[model samples]
Target: MLYRGSCHCGKVAFEFKARLTGVVRCNCSICSRKGALLCAVPHESLTVLAWADDLSTYTFGNHAIAHRFCRTCGIHPFAEDVREGSERSAYINLNCVEGIDISVLSIFDFDGRSA
Candidate 1:
C-alpha cells in the first residue's frame, strides 16, 4: 500500500509503500517527548514528494538515526536510520500519515532508553 504523509505545515511531504505491520512506541527521550507512533519500512520504499529546503535534521547520542523534521512547523515527519551490516530503514511517523486511524493498529513498545 502507498501511504502519503506531510508535516503540520505541509512544508515537507512524502509517500511510501508499506503495510502497517505494527506501530512502534519508543521510550527514548526524544521519542517520548514527541509522542510519535512510528511505522518502519525500507529506506528505498520512501519517496519525498515536496521536500525542498524545508527539511531539517537532528541527531543525538551515537547519531545512528537521522530525525528529519519540517523546519517551519517543527514536525518530525520521519526518521532514517542506517545501521551497520543491515539495510537502511525509514521510520515514518504515523501521526503525519493521511487517513490513518492509529487506534486500529497493533502497537509495539521499544525500549530505546536502554540502548
Candidate 2:
C-alpha cells in the first residue's frame, strides 16, 4: 500500500509504499509525552515528496532513531534510520497519515526509554 502523509500545515508532504508491518507505541519520554502512534516501514519503501529542506531533525539518547519534524508546524511526520550503519527500517508517525483507515491496524507497545 502507498501511504500519503504531511505535516500539520501540509506544506511538507511525503509518500511511502508498504503494507503496514507493525505499529509501535512507545513509553519513552518523547513518544509518551507526544502520544504518537508510530508505524514502521522498511527503508526502501519510504520516500519524501516535497520541501524536505524545510524539515528539522532532533536526536536524544544514543539517537538510534533520528526524529524528523516540520520546522514550521513542529509536527513529527516521519522518522529515518540515520543510525550510522543501520538502514533497517523507518517508523512513520501514523498521526500524520492522510486518507487511510487505521481502525484495523494492530499496535505494539515498546519501552524505548531503555533502548
Candidate 3:
C-alpha cells in the first residue's frame, strides 16, 4: 500500500509502499528517546516527494545509517541503511505517516540498544 509521510511542519514529504505490519520498537538511544515505531521498505519502494534538500542527516556508532529529518521541524521521518543482509532500505517512521490508526498495528521489539 502507498502511504504519504512528512515532518511536523510539512517541509519534508515522501511516499512509500508498506503493509504497516511488523513495525519495530527499538531500544537504541536515539529511537527509544524519539519513541519511533519503524517499518522497513526497500529503497526503490520509497520516493521523496518534496524538500529533499531541506532534510538533515545524523549518524552515530557505525555511522552507516543515515537518520534523515526535516531541518524546519527537526522531525525524523525516515532513515536509510544497509542491513546485515547487504541490501539497502529505508526505515520509515510510522509516526510521520499521514493517515493511519497506529493503535491497531502489531509492533515487534528490537534489541537495538545492545547491538
Candidate 4:
C-alpha cells in the first residue's frame, strides 16, 4: 500500500510504498516525548511530495538517524538512518499518515533507551 503523510502544518509532505505489518513505539528520550508510532521502510521507497526544503532535521546520541520535522509546526513526520556503511532506511511516523487506522495495526514496544 502507498501512504501519504505530512507534518501538522503540511510544510513537509511525502509518500511511501509499504505493506505495513506493524509499528514500533520506542522508549528513547525523543521518541517517548514525540509519541511517534514508527514504521520502517527502505529510504528508496519514500518520495518527498512537497516542500522538502522546508523540513528541518535533528539528531542526537550516535547520530545515526536524522529526525525530520516541519519547522513551522514542529511536527516530526519521519526519520532517516544516516549511518555510514548501512543500507539507508526511513522510519515513518504512522501518526502522520493519512487515513491510517492505527488501532488496528500491531504495536510493538522497543527498548531504545537501553540501545
Candidate 5:
C-alpha cells in the first residue's frame, strides 16, 4: 500500500509506494538519538510533493547518505542515496506514517545504532 506522510508544519509532504514489510532501527549515532524507524521502499516509487528548498540535508561519517527533512518542522521523513552500489534504495520514517499498525510490523535491529 502507498503511504502519505508529511512534516508537522505541512511544508513537506511525500508519498511512498510499498508494503510496510518491516522497520529497521539503526544503531547509528543520529538514528539512535533520533529513534527513527527505517521503512524501506524502492527509490523510484517515492514522490516529493513540495518545498525542496525548504528541505534540509544532513550527512556525516562517510557522507554517503543524504538524510532529508523539513527545515520548518524538523522532521526527518526519509533518507536518500544511502549506499552507492544500491542507489535505488531509500529509507522512509515509519514514525511519520499514519494509518499504519506498527505493532504488527516486524522490527529489525541494525548494528549502526550501537557504536
Candidate 6:
C-alpha cells in the first residue's frame, strides 16, 4: 500500500510504499516524549514530496537516527537510520499518515531506552 504523510503545517511532505504489518511504540526518552507510532520502511521506498530543504533534523545519544521534522510546525513526520554501517531504514510516524485508522493496527513495544 502507498501512504502519504506530512507535518502539521504540510511543509514537510512525503510518501512511501509499504505493506505495513504493524507499527512500533518505543520507550526511549525522545520517542516517549514525541509519542509517535512508527512504521519502518526501506529508505529507498520513501520519497520526499515537498519542501525537503525546509525540514529540520534532530539526533541524540548514539545519534544513529536522524529525526526529521517541519521547522514551522515542530511536527516530527519521520526519522532515518543514518549510521554508515547500519542497514538503512526510514521510520515513518504513522500519526502523520493520511487516510488510516491507527487504532486497528497492532503496535509492538520497543524497549529503546535499554538499547
TM-scores for the candidates: 0.94, 0.87, 0.92, 0.94, 0.89, 0.94
Cα RMSD for candidates in order: 1.4, 1.8, 2.0, 1.3, 2.0, 1.4
lDDT of 6 by residue, 2-83 (tens): 9999999888999999998889999999989999999998898899887647798999998899999898999999999896
Model 2 agreement with the true structure over 1-115: per-residue lDDT tens digits: 8989999988778888877756789999988887788887887777877665788889888777788888888988888877555467887888899876666778899988787
lDDT of each: 0.93, 0.82, 0.89, 0.92, 0.83, 0.92
Model 4 over residues 5-112: C-alpha lDDT tens digits? 998888799999999889999999999999999999989999987664788899999898999988889999999999665589999999999999999999999999
Predicted structure 5, TM vs. truth: 0.89
Cα lDDT tens digits for candidate 3, 7-34 = 9988889999978766899999999988
Cα TM-score of candidate 3: 0.92
Say which prediction, candidate 5 or candidate 6, comes out ahead on TM-score: 6
Which order, best to worst by lDDT? 1, 4, 6, 3, 5, 2
Clashes of each: 0, 0, 0, 0, 4, 0
lDDT for model 1 comes to 0.93
* Tens-digit per-residue lDDT, 1-115, candidate 5: 7799877787888888997778998989989887899887778888988765888999998887788889887998888886655556778888877788878889999998345
Find the 10 residues in a row with the least total lDDT in model 3: 79-88
Give the residue spans of candidate 1 off by over 4 A. Answer: 83-86
Candidate 3: lDDT of 87? 75
